[model samples]
Target: MEKNFTIASLEFCLSQLKRADESVVRKAITSGDGLSESSDDVGQKLSEAHKNAVKQCLTNADKLATLHNQIDACDKVFERLQNMLCSFQNNLGTIGEDMKQLQVQSLDIHQELENRQKVRNELSQFVDDIVVPQPMITTIMDADPNERGFIEALHELHHKINLISSRGNGEAVAVNDTIPILENLKYKAIEKVREWLLLKIYQFRKPLSNYQIFQHQLLKCRFFYEFVLNHEPAIARELQDEYIDTISKMFFTYFKAYASRLFKLTMKDAASKEDSVGAIDTAKSSGISGFFAAKPQVRNRATVFSIGQRNGVLQSDFLGALIVPHAAAQNNQSFQFETLFRSLQLAFVDHYSHEYLFITDFFLVSENEALEIHSKAMARAVSVLLKCCEEQIVVNWDAISLHLCICLCDKFQQLLIEREVPDVNGYWETMSNILWTRFDQVMTNHNDSVRMIDLKKLQNQGALDARPHFIVRRYAELTSAHLTIAKSNGKEIGPKVGALLESSEDAIEQLLTRMSTMQTSHKNKHVFLINNYDLILGVIDDNESKQSRIYAIVHELEQKSIDDFVEVVLDPHIGFLIKFVTECEGLINQGHTQLLVRYNDKISTVITTFNQKWKQSIDAIHSEVMNLFTNFRLGTSILQTIFTKFVQYVQRFSKIIAHEVFSSNSACSEMINVHQIMLEIKKYKPVY
Candidate 1:
């Protein structure tokens, strides 16, 4: 607009100037100014001024014409700006409409999410209430106001459900019950919806992940743990196995997803550099490699066997492998060993620790469970805690589980003895006998004096060292506890006690003679003399010759160095474990001094290792310890009761032992209250 105005003003001014110039010319001519004589100079000056004025007017007009043309170009710019303003206004209106639609969509999505969550929550409660119960039975239980033993009620409900389903009306009607039956129905419905969502997610994820039906298997595992295994632990081992099988299969699916995601990222990165092998190498370096590399060593899914025989052997092997390495390693290098020990330790927990946790729950679980208390009143609660490795996120790869085995073994074994739990290990007699023979060997070893043999000379002389023998002696001075004769009301007997108690004299004699006769050509065989607990060993001069028969003996039995893990191995270093198991068997068979102290010695040995090198076994007291060792087992919540009792037992026993051992005066008190000791232990409960 400004440019247009300026141009118009310029044109007007120039036109006025042209008119004025013309008037000047007319005045000059019309006023009759002479072109001759004295006026000739004035006429010539007028003509020149006229020409100059004409030129000035023409220049002004020409410039005005150019300015008008520039003004025309300004119109184009003005039109473009007007169109831009209109487009911006239109876009703003569209955006406003879009915002309203988005708000509506957001509200709808929120409502949908709320509905689903409500369904999931209500159903979860319903499902929890009747997790092990049937619907009809739950109704019957609920029919009564008393809320006890919903277990049976649940069973009854299941039967009813079966009956209804059998009649082909499975989906027809809802059966309400005492224990949140309608809520349970909604719970199931919510489950259906969740399943649908999960399926959708699966569909979306499948092409990218190649993962199939894995979550379903996880659900099945959850079921087996919650329902079948929780109810019956004899089957727990078997069911857990099935769960692990499913887990292993599912892990592969998870691996594929993880592997593919990682690979795609790497491949994309490498595409610019054209490095395909680099991508593959990166994939292999991830967690999937560890899994695959360990695959070749995977046994046909290890299962639980009796711990009595097998544990001793395994302990021996592990100790043998560990001791030398442990002794040589630097203090800070413990973490490396911890990593190596993790798999075995976990394996130990999976087998033994959990079983004991379930069975001994009475002594383990706390009464005032804070989680339960807080959750009871609130509208919502975070049900349990992160207790085990599976539950935790930042699990250290070097977390050695061996300590878990040690923890369970120590408490449970001592508890069994203190409580006089009978026949716990199942091979009490056999184990006692084995224990006795080792003890006998130890006793004999202490008493005998034998000269050392020369292994070097025998070998160099081109003669197979013919012999070395473990000596045995018969002592008739031992009267073997014969009973005195006694009389009953009407009858007299030769002896009051039964004669079945007599030792097999012939067998004992022959055994001693045979052991004594098998002497080696070399003088000393590290002869061990025995007399009850008294031990006296013969110090041999040639130490290397003393164990000449060790290789042959161990080889024949396949007993040393190599692992015999079916019943478990007896590593040469902890070969004393063989003696331990043997002595335990011997003691049980003979009913010698109640239980085997020899086996107890073995336990003490393990304890010594633990005390000395606990840090070497990386499993630490968990950073966030919930209920102390409450999550003793990872399998299930099935054994909550027995485990609770065990905790109580340990508390009591430790206090009593401490009191007796530490105070000379307190030791005199006999027949004191075990419960009293427990009460004292209650004082030690952590303030957490």
Candidate 2:
């Protein structure tokens, strides 16, 4: 087939070459006729040659057709052979693949069989190790011995039954059918073993063979006795004397935990002579106190302490009292009391949730237990509370301290009310007095330090940031607490403490007012320390109230402090205030307009004064640009005085000017045209 394909390829190549040869002869005959006088004769000869060539081509065509036929035959054979070879190879490949799959399948089956055999062997070996009927309790009414092989055979059958049952394979139906027979065998074997053990147990009682001794020994194993007694408790009683009864009871308790059957068993059903009181007594005497002691807070926690309060103290006494407790506690000579106070505060938070701080509940507590709980819990938990507050709970010094104090006072009042605390001539008076005295001392100390205001330092800082912020926050919360009491609704808040609340509130207000005055005085003193210091003090001394007295000193001192060339102290306070006024353009315009309208005639007078005093500054008659921006602030102020002036300016500038009657006029507007345009301008201020 390969040789035939080669012959066909050669024949095809030769036929193509023959066609090329014929074309060359026909081309030569046609071109010579067009080129010469003898071209006609030359063409005739060429034509004859062409004819000859054509005759040759006829012969070549016959050969070509024959070759084509031959090549077709060869191609047909080659194609058939290729088809056969391909079919044969495809069959071989399929057979090879099938054989490979069969080999893999066979290997898998073989491995599966090997695993099965191995599992079976392991199972058989496991069966061989079984000891037949299990080690057991002594039995008493038979005389026989079980053969070792027979016993082992029964054990092996039991194990096989178990294995077959566990797997639950439908293919193991044969094994399933045999389970009843296997179980029967097991029962027979157990019966036989029982008879044998009974024989051994009785036969060896004289000298006590190993079996008899083993029965006695088995009683000592808690589990062995437990097992035997569980199956036959009445039977166990028949074997029992005093010691056996004790062992049997212990066994029952063990079985209660382990088997969970016959649990909480009792001989009380037999109606014992002893009473149950002794048992109750034993239970009560068990070490429960020590267990409670391990957890002091569980025992000690309570909601007990409380107070009564009132408020005519808003903005003053209320504020002071709020601060006094915390301030005094922080400054206390006894760390213990301070710490206890802190702890109670934290306890109130935890026990009551955050609701306690904002709400007043009756807070009913049990007995003195509540009081004692509070006392001890506070003691136990205070140091920890403070420590946690220090590490993880930072508060705003002023805001929180103040808020917390008010909350504390509120909680204390709630406690008092719940406890039905009595007023007048009693423990309440003593406690109140004690608290007041301590508060007074703390306030006195705080004022002494606070009164020596450092105005120079304050001047270096802004109002809100002038001091450690807590001082202000605490001051505010305390003041607010008294305010809260006065505003409180309902009859819960007591009236007895009303005066005290008012006094505290007044004190807080006075203190703040006093501090403000002193700071003002100090600022005055500092500003004029270079000169007239005595004069400044004298001026401040004339004013009674703090701020007034201090401001009197400051004003004079500031005026006197200016340098010779400067007409003012050159302080930048006004500059900042002015900037504040100007930053918002609409606001500036609004303010200027409002102020101008307020002092309409006054502003005109002031402007006139300025114009007269500084002739060069405002010398423009209407010919000039009006120079609105020379004094920027003044110009803004002027806009306020007469908003229409701006309208006129823009109206005048925005018009078309006419310099002649009949000629093209200037583009800019004439003054009369400006007046006309002014009427059209929107005069209303735009909404921001």
Candidate maximizing lDDT: 2
Provide the lowest-lDDT 10-residue window in model 2. 298-307
List where candidate 2 sits over 4 angstroms from the true fold: 1-425, 454-688
lDDT for model 2, please.
Answer: 0.36
lDDT per residue as tens, model 2, 513-539:
443444334433222231222222232
**What does candidate 1's lDDT look like per residue over 523-630, in tens digits?**
111110011101101211123312323212222322211112211211222234334445555555576744533233345454344334323211121121122222
Query: What TM-score would you give candidate 1 relative to the actual structure?
Result: 0.18
Candidate 1 worst ten-residue window by lDDT: 480-489
List the candidates' TM-scores in order. Answer: 0.18, 0.20
